[model samples]
Target: MDVVNLNQFCIIFPCYVMMILTILWIWRIVNWVWIRPLQVEKSLRAQGFNGNPYRLLHGDSRDMAAMIRDAQSRPIHLSQRNILPRVLPLHHHIIANYGKASFIWIGPEARVLIMDPLLIQEILNKNNVFKKPTPNPLAKYLVCGLSGYEDLKWAKHRKIINPAFYLEKLKNMVGDMSTSCSAMAKKWEDLFEGRMVIEIDVQPYLWELSCEIISKTAFGSRNEEGKKILKLQGEQAELTRQVLQSVYVPGWRYVPTRRNRRLKEINSQVCTLLRSIINQRQKAIELGHVKGDDLLGILLKSNEKEIEEDESNCGMSIDEVIEECKTFYFSGQESTSNLLSWTMFLLSVNKEWQDRAREEVFRVFGNDPLHFDGLNRLKTLTMIIYEVLRLYPPGVIFNRIIYEDTKLGHMTLPAGVHLLLPIILLHYDRELWGDDAHDFKPERFSQGIAKATNNQLAYFPFSWGPRTCIGNNFSLLEVKVTLATILRRFSFQLSASYTHAPAYVVTLQPQFGVQLMLTRL
Candidate 1:
């Protein structure tokens, strides 16, 4: 009788534990989906922010998607200059209806859009308080190196990566950049094939050129292997973009969805390739067969020095190195390619600027082999690049998350709230930039960036403040070289088939490829 009673007691205890665990899980879901959002919405409303009311777990996601689809369906005419409506449809609609100081729901989180330059300056400056939001788990699989890290980790990585983008190092890479650009020019020449002028879409070629330049600069001798890695990263960027568009469901990444599976496969393939490249590099270094001059070489050297000095064993592991390499591939390729494509398109439409830039390139280089020193003399070309960046900045919006209740300007932002800085909107603000804000006038930057906006924090193509992009100089140098090389060989104009639709996919890009008529000089 005693044995039977004990067995029943044990069975009852197990059942009770399961019941309690299930209840706690249900409560957590309820709080996350309903209760917490309501609390945040109330707090925001009391703070004088207005936006679409929160609606269950979806929030404003459904509305945002519908607006984007509608905007994408209609392409603006080439003559139209303001792409704010099309590029950021949802944000445009919210700001128009709810005013500039508005909050929008990103799933359960409330994202407050801050367009005031002063506030943007504050947010960007206080890196400790306003932190980079945690990336979506699915998106993280693609690339998350220095850009994704925070605090000491970010500082450590940035320190290690800084040497690679030093002015001298970037100057060294100009030759590689010019080589890739010249190869692209050769391709265009071949396509002309005795024709004085040939119609071609320069977008894909620009992409390839950017990839090749990054491959050669980042990996040196193993550029062929680097090219394959970059190609895989390109695919990964597209896949990651898709994942970012929707509201991320918790634990949904573990589900064996088609997109998830493909992302995993790509991640695995990229890692394997990177490992092979890194291992080969290590072996070459051991054998003293290679000079550590490329980006990877510089990084490895820096990491070794850091470990030797620190004694904390804080040097980056192989996996961290791989992640940084992925970042170098993605950011290095994306920023320059988009800048060149947009610059070409803008030049194609504005023929006078195109002619002026060509003239500057000729005066500076003068049929000489393009060199690093000549890049600075192309003042007209520099102005043009800056204007293109202002008009169609590669990164449309920058986001930061508040982990603790923080004071931002006059408002006290609550924890768990996200802050958004809409760069496109600021770039087109008539109040700040005057009546010709929407115009493609490159001369605005004639006296330089400080004089352009009266030394305000209004213009930040590569971001601003302490945490500005480390690769800004690297990207600008590459763009200058590529554009100078192309301008020396060919004069271009927009083709009749060209469409003026700028789409945001990780970076701002031509939705329909940039078609142009290139004439050999």
Candidate 2:
């Protein structure tokens, strides 16, 4: 109890504390890189799966990054088997080496392939059983909506947002989409005035068109603001994609790094603009100047109804709604633009199909404005679109995480294992499709999606089941209208400068740009 004895005890206690802390840190690393992964590897091996053995700290991350860098460093040549290797270097390597049902580690967490049609269906169907994992911080900040929610929150959001993308609602917005396309076509016409045909890279134009269409259709009067968001989001998504592709280190965002600070600033800038747009929309709703028809109006109206119906089942916060708006702008614009770009590229390659599609479009509406009725009648055009989607899907893969021990097919998966459903692989699978699965065959889907894969869950460019892309109908209508409008005004073919490289950023886009030579019809 003496002071001198107390001082001695304090000095010794500090050293003991430091020793214990260091031991705990080392044990955590041991568990991550060795003990825990070994246990997971054992479980997967029992299920007849094989893959690269885990390495300390990085696991397969360094290998994946190196592969990606190597892939990017090469020339983007066309006509050979493309996309799969470039988009998902690690996955392609694992599948090629260890077979389809192989596992690879992203840090310590194992991602095992589930390539069977029925098993993939089961995983997607049970939304709650297989939860979506938290994406990189930049991804979450840039785009999160129903993709990020679970349980009650997901149910409520899905219910309210359902009407926004219904066939009926999407039909009403077809004009906005078509009108935007027409403007673009007119601009093209002007640009190629004296020339019989003009060669232009159409990706940037399609990107702008889609952005304008989504902004006008969703936010109505606030498209000017939406344009600002569109510019910022494009940059942010590129940055996020880079971050996700790298070997992710936890707490990297917290450090005062240059990229981190830039991302934070972009986030703040976007949030501020979005808030202004939202407030303006809210004021308009209060004034009864607009119906809850536009996406923003509809979402707010739907959320308000939920709150009125039950206070405990609260609607989304303003910030959550802002996030949803970001999701709408980015995904809606990205997918449709990619779809249109790829379809144009395909049509340019297959001039006979282009002639047939144009013939159909001309027969449906003889120099008239492209409308929903005319679009419905263009079955050939629809067939071409479906075929392009099969060959070049916007999303190469879809992932889900297991939060609890669950049975996928015949075996039980532990909570930490992630399910990897490579949709592009299935789309190109000869077993599901035909000998010409790798070839462009629109006739395959002339019989409709069900008959195309013999009632299989093989084609899901927009995904499938309960959590299907809510903007599916919207995107389709927009794409149909845009393609029809362009086809009517111009007869196009692949330009000599055109290169066929399907790149996978957030979406599968033409890496070298879709260059087409168009003549006024």
Candidate 3:
């Protein structure tokens, strides 16, 4: 009788365990789809934020995807105000349809779109509560290292990387920038002989110019593999574009689909290239024959100094160093090139501004090879670059994920909600820039940035405060040198084949490219 009772008890235990597993699975499903969103939505609504009603399963993901696809399919004409959706659709649409401070659902997540500049200042300034979101895993695979870190890791990385981009360091890179721009101008001059109208988009040349500058300025003489690096960087950028188009599916990267396979393949190639560069740099460091103060040398020196003083004070591991190198190559090359291309494009259309910029360049340098101090003296040219950056910023969309409950404007946001700060929308905002917000007027920046927006946070081409692009000084110096050198050498006009389609990839780029007719003056 005792044995039979024991057997019956063991059978009941198995049944009880199965029931518990089933309950947990159901709870996860319910919480993910309904419970959490409902709670967040209720809280946001309580704060007086009005937005589109959330759809049960889809939320706003479907609409967002459709909008992205539709935008990519059409040709972008810069003359039109509605070339692209106003940065954040929900925020722009909510303001248009509802009012200021409306909510939008972004895939089981509800976010309050804060349009007020004062509110923007508060969020950007308060660093602890609002931080960069956990990056998408796929973004990590494609381009890992810098933008992937959050919280303490981010703070540490930023701290270590800060010294490399200081004003003095940026001054050191101006010569390389001048050399690159000079080489590119020579190529255009050859095509410009006999006043022939060459139908060429200057975008590709600008990209090459920026890549060469990054290669030389970062690696010095070690930039021997720049061509190979450029190829890998281009592939990585294209893959990122493809990844953005498709909705992310978990573990989908491991799947055998053609797109996934191709993406993985690109990832493998970039990894191999970066690994090779890392190996070369390490060997150079071991040999104790450090080159000039290029970016790589500075970074390695900084790392070594920290480790030698106190191992615990070391900012990053060897792996992190390589990742930062890759980030610098990609980000530095992409942003600066996009800025130059757009600046040139804007200058092309506005001939009066172009001539004025040329006069400024000539006045500053006077046939002397471009130098760091000379670049700074070109105040008019500097204002023009700032104006172009304001009009066509490379990083149009800035996203920050909320890690804790935070106050934004009048709303109290919960954890797991992402705040979308649309830099593109803010830059063009009439309330922020007055009636001529859309106009490309460099005079707005003549009095310096503080007085530009009436001391508002309306203009942030390089972002604002803590998380602003670390390389802004480096980028500006490069642009000033490149523009100065190019303007002194050749005069250009818009090519007939040029189409003004400014669109967003990872950065805002000329979709069809910036076509310009060149003539050596």
Candidate 4:
């Protein structure tokens, strides 16, 4: 009788525990999807601001996704460069309905759109107050490096990495940039041999060109194995695109799903490859065989010098250094490729500006070797680059988080609220940019950025304040070399097969790919 009773007690206990666990899970979902977001929305609405009411579970994700789907379904004419409709459907819709200063729900967080230039500048300037929000765990696997780091760690990384992007250092990379761009161009020229004009989608080649430039500059090697490292890095970037589309749920990365497993595998592979390179370089340095002069070389050298001064003050670990290499590779490759693609598209449609740029390139480097000073002399090229950035910024949405309660503009934002400064909205504002905001006019930047937005904090394609893009100068120099080299050899126009669709992947890019008709000059 005693044994039978004991068995019954055990069975009943197990059943009760299962019931209780199920109840708890239901409660969690309710609180997370409904209760918490409703509370935040109430707090925001009480602050005298306006926006769409919070929706269950997905916030505005469903609506935003649907809107994007509908927008991208059609193709706009190439001459219509205003991509605000497709790239930023939700933001554009909200701004139109709820006014400029408004709010929206991205998951449980309230993303307030702060549009005032002064207010935006203040937020960007006060990094301590408006800290970068915690990134998704899976995102860390993609590319976090210096951008995601905060405060002290960020400072250390920036200090060590600064010399790599110094104007003098970047100038040393001009030959590499020219060579990489020309390699792709030569391929295109060969394809067009004995032909007057040939149509080709330019994105694929430009993507290769950007990757090759980084590989040449980053590793300073023409060897076979370094090419594999670059090839893997490029593949990793491609894989991350679909993963980026998902809203990050905590611990979802631990599920060992196919995508998650693949991402982890790729990340591990990249780190391993980078470590091999690092070890080889360290061995060479110890033997006094070479001075590290490439970006990776400079960073390692800088770190070594710091550690030598004080043993306690060590440099980055092998893991950290690998992350940095991935950072440079991803940022340099992604952003510059987009910049070049858009610049060429604009130049293709706006032949007047194309002529102006070609004329300037000829005047500055006409039959002479392209030099560092000559890049500075291409003022017309500078204007075009600035204009392209304004119209088509690679980073469309910049965000900040308030870790504690903070006062912004006319209201006090509660702790944990996220602030969004949409660059596309600001760039296309009529009040800031005058009546021709949507038009393709590089002249706005002719007298320079200060005169462009009437000296307001209105332009920040690379970003603003202390945390602006570290690779901006490096990227610009590459653009100068690639553009100057390509313009010297060929003239291009938009191919009839081309569809004008600017998309927001990890960065803004041509959705259907950029097709151009090339005429070998």
What are the per-model C-alpha RMSD values against the true structure? 1.6, 1.9, 2.4, 3.3
For 405-510, candidate 3 gives per-residue lDDT tens digits of 8767656688888787777777888878889888989999999998998888888888887777788888888888878877887677777678666667778887
- Candidate 1 colliding pairs: none
lDDT of 1 by residue, 64-123 (tens): 778777887888997788898898888998999999989899788899999888999999
Candidate 4 accuracy as TM-score: 0.92
lDDT of each: 0.89, 0.84, 0.76, 0.84
lDDT for model 3 comes to 0.76
Cα error, candidate 1, residue 124 (Å): 0.7
**Candidate 4 error regions (>4 Å):** 1-31, 222-245
**Runs off by more than 4 Å, candidate 3:** 1-12, 76-78, 86-94, 221-224, 241-256
Ranking 3 against 4 by lDDT, winner: 4
lDDT of each residue in 2-58, candidate 2, tens digit only:
999999999999999999999998898788678988898899899889999977766
Candidate 2 least-lDDT 10 residues:
73-82
Backbone clashes under 3 angstroms, per model: 0, 0, 0, 0
Instruction: List residue ranges in candidate 2 displaced over 4 A.
Output: 1-22
* Candidate 1 wrong stretches, greater than 4 Å: 1-9
